[model samples]
Target: MLPRVVRFDLLFVRTDYSDDDAWRDALAAATAVHPSNDFERCGAALQPVESPELSGLTSAQLVGLPRADYLAELAVADAQTMRDQTVLFVDLNELNKQVGRTFRAIPSQVEPIVANFSIANMDFHEFADNADPDGVFRGFTR
Candidate 1:
């Protein structure tokens, strides 16, 4: 028998190497606007994450729980612990397919990290991508 595992796109950028406005850029990368062709006004709450927030959290913590609890957890996360990691969980299926999405949070010197984690099969694999000097992931894979 196979156990089920939910799959979502996990994107991350290290704050230490990115531009000073990394958080704002990260937020922009998370949004897509093409349903009515207007700016998206609402979506997930962006927050800092560490133990429990990232490790101990369950599927329900993201899709089922109230935003307040999650936000509260983020509020107390040790700023020191969150020093350089910036991560966002997204669903490519939920995004507007009509629009083109380019990954921009990673820097050129930083080789982009792309991977697949499978729970049903209990395995993980990493894929590769080529990056320009500016760090935007152009559609081709290396």
Candidate 2:
């Protein structure tokens, strides 16, 4: 059986606007709302950050680019890790607090063994689809 995955969205309560009413009441108040989009339950594979340089970018710079592609890259990377069983668990408890505020953090984890100031943004789905599929994926998908 596949391990259950959960989608989490949190409101810092410090931001100017919180969509707490929408997501909170719509989904049982378990998720939080910020200026960004909703959070979904991604698989273990979705947790790893493949491009250190890309992942290391500031949220402002990333937002300037095509966010959909970038998110796709994260989705693909995460899916692969789930398949490999080498998934890394990034502690998002603190990072969750930073979203609407300043959004600061470095990726600190043990499994893949990498450390860097990073932010988790899965909004690059478009970039991910356009990347070298072979390297990102063991087998190219149609």
**TM-score: model 2 vs. ground truth:** 0.19
Error of 2 at 56 (Å): 5.2
Which residue runs of candidate 2 sit more than 4 Å off their true CA positions?
1-46, 52-56, 69-101, 104-142
Estimated TM-score for each candidate: 0.24, 0.19
Please give, for residues 47-107, the per-residue lDDT of candidate 2 as tens digits.
2222334433333343233332212111111222323322212222233332212211111
> Over the stretch 9-68, how does candidate 1's per-residue lDDT look in tens digits?
232312232233644444444332213222333332223232233443322343333332
lDDT of 2 at 119: 33
Evaluate residue 13 in candidate 1 and report its C-alpha lDDT on the 0 to 100 scale: 19
Q: Which one is best on lDDT?
A: 1
Relative to the true structure, how large is the alpha-carbon lDDT of every model? 0.27, 0.23
For model 2, what is the error of residue 42's alpha carbon versus the real structure, in angstroms, after optimal superposition?
14
The residue-level lDDT of candidate 1 at 141 comes to: 36
